[model samples]
Target chain A: MIEVKDLHFAYGSNPHDTLRGLTFHIDDGEVFGFLGPSGAGKSTTQKILIGILNRYRGTVSVNGLNLQNLNSDFYESIGVAFETPNLYTKFTALENLEFFAQFYGSGTRDPMQLLTAVGLEEDAHTRVRNFSKGMKVRLNFCRSLLNNPKLIFLDEPTAGLDPVNLRKLEALILKEKSRGSTICITTHDMHVADTLCDRVAFIVDGEIRLIDSPRELKLQHGERFLDLEYRDGTSLICTSISMDKLGTNEIFQKILYKYHIETIHSREASLEDVFVKTTGRSLQ
Target chain B: MRLLAALKQDILFQFRHGFYYVYAVLTVLYIITLRLLPETLVYPTLTIILFTDICTLGFTFIGAIVLLERGQNLTESLFVTPLRLHEYLLAKILSFLLLSFASAFFVMLGASVGGHDRMWFVYGAIFSALIYTLFGLVFAARARHVNDYFVKSLGIGLAISLPILAYLRLFDTPLFYVFPTRATLILLDVLDHDYALSEKLFSVASLFIWFLVLSGWVYQRFDKYVRHPA
Candidate 1:
């Protein structure tokens, strides 16, 4: 759904490029995450893809059209939720959605339904200025879904939300995936990336250090042993054993047959660990 | 159809913002003040009030709205939508024009001013308001905050309207005709007299030309701001 090659952007005559020869493609219906620290060109790259920022030095094609050549019709097929809540503070939640929905010619979902989906049904009539940060974030996400867009760009979509709302939002995003929508999210939240993304690109200083699925990356970078915890009288014993040939190993069989095992967990690397190892920098 | 929808939305938003209410109260106050003026002073007083409120104040109102939208990041979001720049600009101009006309009409009605061409008065007020509103867009586009906008708008308002005051014989100079405000002042001047066709045509032509030039400049500046905002 999106293709970018050799993309280079510098803000207003700055000698350093914000995005340096970045190349990546997002498949249709895939949830692609651009993972990076703050000011790591993640938002800039998303902005270019969404047609908000032009004058870059490379080809960016969304839905098969060059970003520079696309017009207002381009917006009809895509939706964007910016990092900051760019909402009308004075307007009610429903009013803000309705006002923006008028700009789309057709295929707009009902504003109230979207609000309800985000658990904002009760605050539909409340002015946005009175909403908390989490409420505004939910409303912002709701606004992006108004057009029922084919491609969605969400920047830090789960920021400032409590666990319940976060889970609700993640479910809604998964629902969008089920509907075959192409979703691209830019965030530093590793857990969100691991849970929601089909593939993630670890970016630092405008460069992609690594790109792979979270599961695949973890498996590749994780230790090859499993840690076993067992109870022995009043003490707990923890031991590690390699996975290879464990079925026929006498020590593993004897431990399992003789002692009660409390927990056995594989020493798998997390997405955050892989990201820090690969990029040589933290996601923060 | 989209333009109309956007226009409706903008108008509704402005009403909810209490812009119309505040202007309504001020319009009534101006009308009451005009009503107490002596019969001999009523015509010039009406002209002055319309010029100040509709023309000068219209600029400030448009500037404030634009700056407020910028602060709220509305302009950034609007830029990504299907709304064209000209449609957005026209919606703002037309909405403000309607409010300014209402103010002018109520002031005229309350003052009971007679012996003037009503159509000419309406046209003058609209053209003046358009010119000033366009000027406001230019200033608002460059301003970073309300205080910056206020300072710049004050300077621009003074520079433009000072010529109108001079043409009204607050100060004497034929040189004042060189400014665009001359066209508006001449339109107001023709209201109280049975002016010659040539003089009326000249004022209309001048105001139309000013409108075209100012609209072009405003659109160019506004488009640049939308594409590459500082």
Candidate 2:
């Protein structure tokens, strides 16, 4: 649904380029997560895709239409939830949604339905100034979906959410995917990407270090070794073995034939581990 | 059509604040205060005083509204939407004008029954208030902070009104007549059924010119400041 080719962007007339010929694509109904720490150009890339920060030196097309030639109608086909909760505090949650809903000339969703989906139906009449950060984020999330956008740009949608609410929001993103919406999410939370994304891209310093399925990347970078643990009398005995030749090895045969094995497992790498190893930086 | 919906929502949202109540109370207080003033102190009709109050207060209201929107970052939010910048700006101006006119009209209605001409006061108040509001929007757009608008507008108001007020109280001069206050005074005279015909015509022309010039400035500045989403 979205394609970016050799995308490069720089702020103003500055000599330094923020994006250095980066390229990526997101297929239809795919949840693609751009994982990176802060100041790693995660937001700058999202801003370019959403058409906020202009003056780019690349080609970006959303839903088969070139971004350079698209107008406000392009906004009609997409939803955007900015990292910051930029809303009108003077208006009620419902009023904020309804006001923005009017900006689209066609296919506007019902504001009440959106509120209900985000679990804000009960507080629809209360002014947004009285809302908490999480509540405002939910409202902002609902606002993005008001146009029934085919593609959604979510920048740290789960940042201010608690675990329970985070799960609820994650489920909502999954629901949107089930309804055939392509999502481009940028977040530093590895768990979210691991659990929700169809594919994840690790970005560092405005460049894509790696992009692949979570399971595949983990398996590829993982150590091919096994650890066995068994209780021997009053003391616990641990042993390590190479998985490269485990079947024909006498030690592995002895452990299976002579010892009472309590647990045996291969050393598996996690998404966070692979992210750190590839980027040489932590997700913090 | 979509722009109109956004505008209607903005107007409704603005009216739901406590500040609207404060504006209503101030209008009532101004009417009662005018009634208490002795005859010698009251040069023009009470309706003219009420109209002038609207013109003064409208400037402050628009400045405050724009500053509030800027402070909350709602202006940038609107910019990202499909709503045109001109439509959003016009909606704000229209809402301010309508709200101020309603308050001024209620006061003038009561005052007109006593001695003032209703039509002249309504027209003059609406005209001058709109001109002052357009002037306020220019400053609001340029102001970096909300409090800065308060200080700058107060400075501008004083710089424009202080000399005119001093001259009117001290000595009459042809130069003083060129000021907005002097033109407003002529407007009041016309509203109170006492101005010469030529002065009344000149007041209308001068007030219209002020409205035109300030409105022109708003359009020019608005175009330069607003960057629509790509």
DockQ scores of the candidates: 0.59, 0.37
lDDT of 2 by residue, B109-165 (tens): 544333455455456666777777887888777776768877878877755454345
lDDT (CA) per prediction = 0.85, 0.77
For every model shown, what is its TM-score relative to the native structure?
0.95, 0.81
Q: Which pairs in model 1 have colliding backbones?
A: none
Residue A182 accuracy (lDDT) in model 2:
92
Docking class of 2: acceptable
Among all candidates shown, the one with the greatest TM-score: 1
Best by DockQ: 1
Docking quality category of candidate 1 according to DockQ thresholds: medium
Q: lDDT at B192 for candidate 2?
A: 42
User: How do the residues B57-168 of candidate 1 rate in per-residue lDDT, one tens digit apiece?
Assistant: 8888888888888888888777777778888889988988888878777777777775557666567778888888888888888888888988978876787676765656
